[model samples]
Target: MSKPLSPSSSYDLHPSVAYVQSILANLEARTGRTLEAWVALARAEGPSDGKARVVWLKAQGLGASQAGLVAQRAAAGPGHAFDDTPAGYLAAAPGYVEAQYGGKKAALHPLFERIVELARSLGPEVKICPCETIVPFYRNHVFAEVKPFASRLDLGLALGDPAAVADLSGRLKDTGGFRKKDRITHKLELTGVADLDLALAWLRRAYGRDLKA
Candidate 1:
């Protein structure tokens, strides 16, 4: 597993966010240019199209991965979703969750909060990492995610082999499979607080599976 964001920091990060931060943190060391410099280069000289800019950066001597990262930052420009630094992104985490539950989805905030409470109760290691749309709950890995809809929420779980789990026989819908590279392999649609009991049960199972793995 990767190291925590900081020795004294209390926040837990989603794996994808962590990966991007890792790449950005090392950008200067690997390419001799900061992310700001790379974005400026891409905007000034590279193609305007994002994919084309990645190719252009690669041709200009950046590795494939670094080129892709630079292209993404350039395309997003200033005030990007994850921001320009790890600390900045971490600071904006709460706003991300608030955005997801705003407007027509505001009514679902209570349900999302309840789910978060249950997820945290599982263990202290359970980190609530909110992205633009979904809120992913991570244990050793991402065990579950809570995605809000205008009228309902989808609780996604990474249950290993849903077919073998009798308790989840018809209680969840398949989210493809790990073999197919889907981190969340099943989901339960929750319309209200009444649906939480079943959701909590399935969440516990998913968390336990990740714990053992």
Candidate 2:
């Protein structure tokens, strides 16, 4: 028989596994069943996978959230939502994107919306996400970011060859070695949609450069 999962066993587990592990660590105290007990029940239900196993656990009398955690543990073993996967992180904080533009920051919502619209048009491969601090625009990797300030929005782009975009230095302004290793070597300030046309043009070129790289 496999050894039971313990909270201290989460050193190298996936984010989702580690996330579930924390809450379920004291499983028997709360749910009246140890982690091993839950998995044994799930396995007894016969061969299954993913949501199906979760559904089975729920029908077996575990509450929805607990069942979901047990099913995930049964399938993949120990870990937590902070493990590293983008989906895992998002699952842990579903309102992260909305919270970024809520309250006093609401004034910048439209600006981020416009940036997202343009980012989506880049291609099917583009992933616009709030990674760490900045909302990064990813094409294979982060090719751009939309960071809002209380006064203006800073649009960062990765155009690879700095010289090719150096002519815009007076307009776009060099990032002055911020995250120097990143392809996002330039930034433009935007106060409103009025700046969208020029920014979009720069992003289009940056997208091409990112794909080529």
Give the per-residue lDDT digits (tens) of candidate 1, residues 1-213: 122233124345555666777777888998899989988989999899988998899998888878888888788554455543566667877778778888999998877877887787778779887777788888888899999987889999998776676763466887787668877988899998788789889999899888644
TM-score, per-candidate, Cα-based: 0.84, 0.56
Q: Write the per-residue lDDT of candidate 2 for residues 43-146, one digit (tens) a residue.
A: 77735787888878777777777887777767755443443444456554324455666777778877767777776676776765564345777776667887
What lDDT score is found at residue 84 in candidate 1? 38
Model 2 clash tally? 11
In model 1, the clashing pairs are none
- Model 1 TM-score, all chains together: 0.84
- Which portions of model 2 show Cα errors greater than 4 Å? 1-87, 92-94, 166-169
Kindly give the number of clashing pairs for every candidate: 0, 11
